[model samples]
Each structure stands twice: as C-alpha cells, then as structure tokens.
Target: METFTEWRTWERARADLAARSLGPDDLVVLDRAVDAALRWHGDQRRPTGAPYAEHLFEALEVMVRGAGVTDLDTLVAVLLHDVVEDTDATVSDVEAEFGPDAAELVDWVTKPPAGGQGRQAKRVAKTAYLRRLREAPPDAIRVKLADRVSNVQTLDRMPPDFQRRYYLETVTYVMPLIELLGDDTGGWFSGWYTSWRRRFGHLG
Candidate 1:
C-alpha cells in the first residue's frame, strides 16, 4: 500500500523501526529528532493540511524501510531537513544540536532562497539547486531522493496546473540525481517518478 497518510505520530514511527529490526540506538536518535522537529514546527501544516511532521516521518520511513538505511545521522537529517526552510532554524542550529553530518545532509536537501521571486524564478532556483546535488555526498543525495519520494506521494492533491509543472520539474531536475543517489534508493525514486507520471499523465 502507498505510505502517504494524513500524519504519522511518534508511536507509528516507533512501530516502523521495530518492524525493520532497528536497535535501541536507532530509536534514540529518531526519538530525539522527532521531538526536535515537533518542537520547532509546532502548529505548522502542509498545503495538503497534514501536520508538517508527517512529511519528515514519511521521508524517514522512505530512507529506512524503502532504502534499508540504518544510519543514525542520515535518519536524523531526514527529520530535521525542512526545519531550515520552513522555520527560523538555521544550519548552525542543526549542527549544534545534531552534529555536522546531519546539518550537512540537511543543507544538501535544502533549497536555496528564491528571494521572494515569482514561480518562474523559483523554478530557476530549484534547477540550480538540483544541479548542485550532482556534486553532493551520496548520503545527502539519498536524503533528497527520499524527500522527493515523500513529496510526490501527495502530489495528486495539488491543482492540475501545479501538478503538471511539478511533474515536469521532477523529471527535468530530480530524475538525473538517480545515479548520484545509488542503486536501491535511486531505483525506488525512479520507480515512483515513472509510476507517478503514468498515474498523473493527464495533468501533464
């Protein structure tokens, strides 16, 4: 079944890890990351009306269950990835709390500022960001690949025109990163993109 849901609570995250045979050390990092994400993103909601934390949880699920990632820093980075973009949180703040590795991964996935530009300029900024991903560390690329997977899972809720533009952007910008993201994880993201195109082709 598709993993997209309205929200994922801490209990659900615990259950997901337990099912995957991740150990206590994994649990500790994930718990701390989740707590921090909630503390920072309290009351924020995605455009789809889901609590913002669900996006982070789903991205972690993609990394762990879908990509078989057990790395603590990678998982923690997924949880805090959007904090810098959506909140007042900074890369230094994340580094101070979770360490340099997580902060770096978050930075790789974080989109640079568009300077309050219009849609076209924002697209240009995103294109530039995707190009930079080609040079990012492998784990950082994986985090972004997983992030795209989570984001696309809810794409159907978007307006038709927006869906068309987003699908095109994914193909043009994100598809090339598959090689940088490595085989298993990259393959999953490719499959999601392909299937999403077929499912939403009319919008495109």
Candidate 2:
C-alpha cells in the first residue's frame, strides 16, 4: 500500500504536498520545478530503469515528509537538484527560473566533473564532493542527504560491487555529515541509515 510517507511517483508526491501547509504561491513554484525537471530529464532512467523523475520525487518527498521541511525554495531545489548535474541545465538556468537561493543550493549538491578518466578519478571527484558538502548550507546538506537516501535505499537492484562502494561512501562521508547536524532531520536519517546498514551491511 502506498502511504503518505512513500512518494516515488508524482501522483503520491503531489497528494502529499497538497496535504502540507503550503500556500498557493508555494504550490506554483513547486509545480514549475516539477515541470522543469520532467522536461529537462526527458526519458532519462535510473540504473534500475525507473523514470528519472521517480528519484526526484523521492528526494523531494524525503525533504518534505521525512525531514519535515516546508520552505518553498528548499523544496524546489530538491526537485531540481540533479537537473544541473545530469542534464543540459545549468546553474544560471536554475537561478533564472528559481532564484539564487535555489540555484546555490542545487549547485552546492551537484557533483563536479571528474578531473580524469575511469573509476579512480570518478571516485576522487565523488570524495571531493562529499567533503565539500560538509560546508554547504544546512538546506543543501539536507538536499544531499535526501538524495543519497533515495539513491542507496534500493541498492539491491544494482550490482553487488556498486552497493558496496555506495555503502562505504554513505557511511564514511554522508552518515558523518548527518551526525554533525544533530537536528530533527539528522535523527531521522540516523535511524534510517542504521536500519539500512543492518539490511545491506553484508554487501558492504
């Protein structure tokens, strides 16, 4: 059964947002973000072959429902976070459409290009990104945590090696980042990751 807390689909996400305390203007902004994400992602799919929008929705839902975030700009950034990294969209494009706060938040969470080829270089870039993420604004950190949660929550669908790599990265960097917060969102993620580790620790 689909619950208010689980929103991997637009229909569930929209319904959950409607039940929240957003004003009309907030809804408009979020709607534009959704439209932009879908349009820009255009047929993109996850490694498990789910529509890319599903990941976006899951992140946004984690922010709103799981983390109790309701700020319009933060939520908008959650929806559009991957747009700059994975699509032709740029930070300027995000800023022009969503304003500078959302732009900065999205840029803070977006992974920089790898400096060299192959897995080693990509690993370096990813490591650098996670370390840099430690200094991002609290909202950006939340966005990244929510993004990682959505990404790693379903690792079994991918190869075991990928699962192991992601688990180490999450524990080494992302989980520590959450620990530093010591806030409500941090508590939520602590519980979630602990349970997740119990289920997937063997793979790691």
Candidate 3:
C-alpha cells in the first residue's frame, strides 16, 4: 500500500476532478466549502492518523468528479460531510452559510449517539441513525455513499479489529443506504461496494 505521505489516492482524485471539467463557479464554491470545513475542523486528525481534510476532499471528489454529480447542493454536502461529527460546527451554521439544502444534507449525514450511551445504547443509536439515513434527502445519501466508499478503501490502514468492525458495519449499515441515492450516485457506490465485498466478504 502507498504510504500516507505519497498520497497516491489523492493524486488519482485530482486527476479525476481535472477531467470532470468543473466550471469556474463549481471551483469557487468548492474552494469556499473546503476553507469553511478546514476552519471548523482545524488541526483535527482521524484515527488513521491522516488530516481530516483529506477525507473530506476525497468524499467531495468522489461525488462531484467521480460520480458526475454537478448539483451544487450535493457538492457542498460532500465537502462538509464530517463537519458536524468532527467539529463544533452546527447545522444552523451550515444552513446560514450554504443554505437549507446543504445544511439539511449535512445534518442528515451526521450521526450522534445518545448522550451518556453505553455499548448497547450506541448500537441502538447507530441502528436508528441508519434508519434515518434511509429517509434522508438524496443529496445526503450521495454524500454518505461517497464517504463510505472512501472509508472502505482505507480500511486496511486501520487496526485489525477496527477493520473487522468497520467492514461489518459497511455491509450492514452503509450498503443499504447506498441504494437510496440517485442513479448516478448509487451506481458509483455499487461499484465500490462490490469491490469491497469481493475483497473482504470472508472476514468476520
């Protein structure tokens, strides 16, 4: 696998985005969205020890450039996909800045467990989150699918037990949600899901 600093994954994403012919407006909006997300998630890092912005950018690139999604709302949602989860950013802040659709999409995708939850409670909360994701807006689902696809591809970089848990969660929780997106997004998600299933289906 490529080292994190090599960033081969991001390089491929950049190539795809370049080929997508994103308009000047698209570029402007995406730049603003990235800047906002960075300000919100300043200096945060994921468990995998990578800058959180990398994951956000990957999700946005997958949806906007890889899935051929041109809708402004979906693109914005992709860029801000993890803000509510990883930062102090509020849904109202997103709404006031990016409008209702983008904020709603981000809110739908954010999964917050019930306060003071234990293991079973967290599991129940997760189940409920997935259920709500089913009823969420299509743009939210699109951002979610893109996020899951990126996560699955990087699963190997995590610890063995975490990988197992994440794999099972992807199959059980995320795969169904992927089916709820628009045609183009569902197709992109299916491609990633099929590859993940083929490579890791035998694991617990």
Q: Any idea what lDDT model 3 has?
A: 0.76
1-204: candidate 3 lDDT, tens digit per residue: 111222224446445555677676766776778789889999998787888878877676666656778788888888887888778899998998899988888989999856555888888887788877888877787788878767777677788888899888888878888767648668866876787788877665
RMSD for each of the candidates: 2.0, 2.1, 3.2
Give per-residue lDDT, candidate 2, residue 122: 94
Per candidate, the number of residue pairs that clash is 0, 0, 0
Task: Put down candidate 1 lDDT per residue, 1-204, tens digits, no spaces.
Answer: 355452377798788687778898778877888888998898999888988888888888788777778788998998998989888889999999899999999988888898666988887787888888889988888888778878887788888877888877777777778866666767776776677667767765
Alpha carbon lDDT at 11, candidate 2:
72
Candidate 3 displacement at residue 3 in angstroms: 14
TM-score of each: 0.90, 0.94, 0.87
Model 3 residue 199 CA deviation in Å: 1.0
Tens digits of per-residue lDDT for model 2, 24-63: 7888888899999999999999888888988988888778
In terms of lDDT, the best-performing candidate is 2
**Model 1, C-alpha of 200: deviation from truth (Å):** 2.2
Please give the distance, in angstroms, between residue 55's alpha carbon in candidate 1 and its true position after superposition: 1.1
By lDDT, the candidates rank as 2, 1, 3
Worst 10 residues of 1 by lDDT: 1-10
Q: After superposition, how far is residue 48 of candidate 3 from its true place, in Å?
A: 1.8
Rank order (by TM-score, best first)? 2, 1, 3
Kindly report which residue stretches of model 1 are placed more than 4 angstroms away from their true locations once superposed.
Answer: 1-7, 115-117
